[model samples]
Target chain A: MKAVPAASTVEVDGEYRLKREGTSLQWNIADESALEAALRLKDGDGIVTVLTMGPAKLEAALKELLARGADRAVLITDRRMAGADTRATAAALKAAAEKTGPFDLILCGRRAIDGETGQVPGELAAALDILCVSNVERLEKTETGMRLFRRTENGVQELEAAGPLVVSMCEYAYHLRLPGILSMRRAKSKTVEILTADDLELKTGECGLKGSLTKVITMEAKYPGLRKGPKETDLSKATEQIQAMLREVRP
Target chain B: MKEILVLCPHGVDGGLLSKAYALSEGNLRVLVLEGEEQTAEGYGAKYIHTIKTTPPDEAAFAGWLAEKIQSWGSTIVLAPATIAMRNIMPMLAWKLNAGLTADCTALDMAGEDLLQTRPAFGNSLMASIRSLSTIQMATVRPGTFRPVEQKANEPEIIPESGPAETGKVRELSFTEFAGGKPLSQADVIIAGGMGVGSKEGFEKLAKLASHLGAGLAASRSAVDAGYAPFRCQVGVTGVTVCPRLYIAVGISGAVQHLAGMSGSEKVIAINSDPKAPIFGYADYGYVGDWETIIDRLLHLEEETL
Candidate 1:
């Protein structure tokens, strides 16, 4: 799970990337839903490890995840891993998962609120040589593997898949549980395991901006809903005009 | 000239196919997985390769597509932003060591480079991206472009061998949601926001929508507040709709809300706040209580009926 800049607090720099410095951060809502799914799927002796890739400041966010029932927290951060696109980011994540994993399931939000590319999970799955499912809204533990209900634009796809696969979840699929006082206290004593690029064995060109294949050419502030329309504060006139426009629409 | 490849997994999205045709400038090759060759030919694709899938598998499909794309000597690839493509494209990009932009709203070519434009930062910024790899890829929004009205071409249809690798995930069943006309295809939409107050308020809007023979939509705030379901939410996270007429009832237009419905041809906003940002986008603005405005509109509709 990653702590993204709050939607309201998102500000773009001249280069078109989000200015993450001093920005208010919150759990990417979709990732929180994934966390919720992980928590619910935890059976006896099952551990939910919350992992994220970002700067050193993200340790606080990981600690908060630890408070929210995560048995362990992993923070993959390094100075060389800045400006990584989805592919490069996935490469770094794939390395971290290889170093610390060999687990049953890996869950992520369908897309992050910031970039919203939603390509990381698939790329990471490719890097790890695993199956990946996207747009999964609901899932349940079956005798063999799991049963997943994936919501798509046309219909709902039902799939029976085994573990050792990556799944990306919808934002509102599961509501995250809040941290209890006792859990918060316990979380304070736990140290967040930090993994740098060197620890992951990511080569010099395969870590950060240099590793990314996509480049943002330009970014412009989108002035949304810029239609020139006449306004009327008069209730009677407004109703009359709306009635007229309604008549024009083909049934 | 390098080949521009388009993938039609479920079928050829006419709008997406036409957009690819425009970008490729008549030189287009399409790979249809379980889609009809005639539909692709109608969009003026010169070469169409039809392939069958025993089961949908992203990893296996990506590996196969990567090899095919390389063999065809294609430099750019485009697919509709459907669930399957969204799942498969990233893996394909990884296998090919390519870069991909997701849900691109616009596409252009700048001196052999594919310029992909999409919303960034919750639709507050528009970013134009380019891939540094040999092959550039993008999954476009389904209905972002208009379908081509051109006649069919005598395209060469080849049957390609399917992927041999079987996936672990097994398909069970698919349940298609039954409803009236979907909001995306609706000619007119009556959308409500938080100012609509509750589920009961959305019911009122639904009544008006039924009366006017229109679709019902909701702002993200309304959906988040539990007044409406995510399917009805209109915003960046939800579906992007372009309708002939859109009515914003009790909606205080946030940029996120506007991102979804801004493509609407005509807008009518009804909010108690005269300064609601929705009014700025509306062709007609009414300042009053939603119940009062809805009641009047319904009364007017009833009288006409």
Candidate 2:
């Protein structure tokens, strides 16, 4: 699970990247749902490990996941991994998966709230050379594999995958449970495992800005209103105005 | 010469094809997997390529396209950002060691580079990006571009065949979303948010929507609150809509919600909060009780008819 900038706390600098220095972070909403699904599916002996790639500041957020019933937490953080685009981020994540996983399934939020690219899960699947399913609204563990219901624009597609798979979970499919006082206390002692570029055996050239394939040319703040000033009115007048607008559109 | 490769994996939306064709500068090679060649030609495709075998899933299709892209030697690729292509394009880009911009709102050529523009930071910021790799790729939403006028043209048809990755994920069933007209296509949308209060409140909104021949849409909070269905959701996490008129009731106009409906031609906001962000986006604002407003609107519609 990734800790992204809270929507309300997002601040973009004059430079290309977001200004993360003092911005607050929260578990991505879709990722929380992904984590909830994992927690629910885990059997008695099954372990729910949460992995995230970000700066060291993300450790606190990972511990929060540990408090909320995750068995383990791993943070893949390296100075060299800074400014990694989706592809390079996938490369680093692929290495971490190899280091810590031989698991049956991988779950990711459909997209990061900040980038809103919705591309990492597919790129990660490619990097790991595995099958990927996205926009999955529901999942059930089967004897051989897993059955998933994916929400598309027009319909719901029910699919079954037999091998290792990457699933990009739909937002709020499952609400994440909050940690109890006892669990929160116990979670403080559990250390979050850290992995660096050297630990993943990733080359310097294949990490961070150097490894990224895309560059942000510019960023412009999108102002909210097209209308310079709205024609504010009472209920009666608003109703008339709406009627006029409706006629203009419908007629 | 390097050509603009538009991947119409499924049926082509003419708008997407025409827009790509215009950007292609008469050098567009359309790769249609399960789509029609005639549709591509109708939208001004000159060099049409059709896949012989349909790949089972996005993973298999991406594998096939990656190999074909190398052989075709096209540097720039565009596809409609449907669910399947959203999955396929990234994997294809990864395989080609390329950069891919997702859900691009705008596309242009910066010299030889494909300048891709999209909403970033949950629609608060618009980012313009470019790929540095050998191949440049981007996926555009289906209706963001308008279809060019259809014209009669003779097009070269090329048949291509490849091995597909098979027997991985099996499709069991598909259920088409049923009910009123889809939110994206609706000319007028009556969207409710958290203040709708309950499922019953949404039903009231639905009644008003049906009365007006409009579609019912909901904010993410409304969907989360179970006041509305996921299909009716409009936001960053939901469907982006560009209706001719959008009537927002009780929506606070979170940036996420605003992103989806920012394309609306005109907006009318009905919220109790006088200072709601939604009022800033609205062409007309009414700070009052939504229930009273909805009831009045329903009565007004009946009388107007």
Candidate 3:
């Protein structure tokens, strides 16, 4: 394997703190699908980096990435970035990515579990002016470029594109690899670089509360019906009921 | 008292409109936009604002909606989380600079804010989000909210005139899938996945669907396997459904598949593998060969009925 300096970050409290100081291979929470695909490609000795912006409590997510196979981690911690909408969060990530430098691939999950808008990848791609492929299922490193299998409304589509690309990986792309004992041991000693507003040369208006284009006006909890424990039935009876119900509905 | 404005799309299903009305509480004024005559009549909202359409475009629609939002001084806006609605609502939200929660499975009036609950992280977790802005917006998933019964005999309708604009994405042509029924609207669904084995196996599932007077649906894997059409696939990439009864046969319930039909009133799964993920969420599960079980059920149906 070519030695590409990798960099990844963790968002602690809300700052993009970099791990591995100056290394190239970085892994962060790529919660967008298209971004993940772009990052999985095997490019020449060029470093791969990942970064995330979230609360200090999310260190576990960052650590998990390291255990899986990331080179380093950076944690971005600050209170100002809390409860940020997509635009604000994307801005923070964009700022961090710009500072990380000369990256060839950026990967993210197609949509974060918390916010399923599926907009950040496209929005970030727009910000970076890079090509983005969303909902990618499989990614392979090609000799000339990267080949990707993306899921669509119709079926899986295969595409070959050249780097500096940003692709998002679908949830089903691969079972997140578990960190082996050796990798976990190494990650335990690995130092993470923490970044804040000062480290990243971001405009005050573009960083946190001020940069967000939208705001949440109101919030109310929804009460989906009460959860009942699993209902148990014998196979024969269950099968009979299913048959009867189908017959009644059909007849 | 704070005034909240709920924006119901012009031609949404009457069933969906009823649910939207039920969700409304004190001081929440529901405004149904008049898009098509059929939709307007079915919705029967107290306030119906009509916009003339001559070749619709995003700019014209945005202009029309912006004028109304300003005039009404609406606080909150609600729309169905469908592809069509999602395409337009984001632009509208951007124009208004309002925070919008998309694909909200649950909505409730929590003090001053609307507590929106939606699935996050591959449907493994649920997050409750609140907007901290003047105009809170949300797009609710269809079939999650229960439509209320119509109380009034005739609902008041208001019509307004405005200039129509051209649409950004022009519909050059439209083609409807030739199938049993659209899975999203189906009351009963018979869906299959990779476990169905072959094309001949899929035919059996189709027969079961037809016999049940239900729509035939498939998982993404089934579609990938070429056993079903893309439109009939049910998942994140396909259609989300809240059918009355969903029967999954020869399919292991992946989170993607569950995301589409988890809201069904009843779910039954037939798989030989007892540990299949589908059994976890199923109301009833049979740990046996699908072919044997389905053949038995079909025979039972014939003998009994």
| Runs in model 2 lying further than 4 Å from the true structure | A10-21, A180-189, A232-251, B33-35, B51-56, B159-165, B180-187, B208-214, B272-275, B286-305
Among these predictions, the greatest DockQ belongs to 1
Tens-digit lDDT string for candidate 2 (B146-218) = 7785575688988777555587888889898755566766789999999889999999999888887788999
Q: Listing candidates in order, what is each one's chain A TM-score?
A: 0.89, 0.88, 0.70
Alpha-carbon shift of residue A187 in model 2 (angstroms): 4.1
Query: Compared with the true structure, what per-residue lDDT tens digits does model 1 show for residues A171-201?
Result: 8899999998987998989999999989999
Candidate 2: Cα lDDT at B250? 94
Please provide, for model 1 over B73-119, each residue's C-alpha lDDT reduced to its tens digit, 9 standing for 90 to 100.
88899998877898999999999999999989899988899999998
Off by over 4 Å in 1: A10-21, A233-251, B33-35, B52-54, B164-167, B180-187, B207-215, B289-305
Question: What is the per-residue lDDT of model 2 for residues A1-251, given as tens digits with 9 covering 90 to 100?
Answer: 77777677654454434455777788888999999999999999998889998889888888888999988899999999999988889999999998998788899999877777889999999999999999999999998899999987778899988889899998888999999787688898899999999999999989999899999889887744455346455778777778888889884
lDDT for A132 in candidate 3 is 61
Just chain B of model 1: what TM-score? 0.86
lDDT of 3 by residue, B1-305 (tens): 34555555534555545554545533334544454534534443444555444222333454467678878888778777654355345556655656677777777776777777776423434567777667887777766665544544354455666545332223233334445466665788988888888888888877766666678889988988889866677865556778888888888877567766777787888787877878877877777777877777777656755
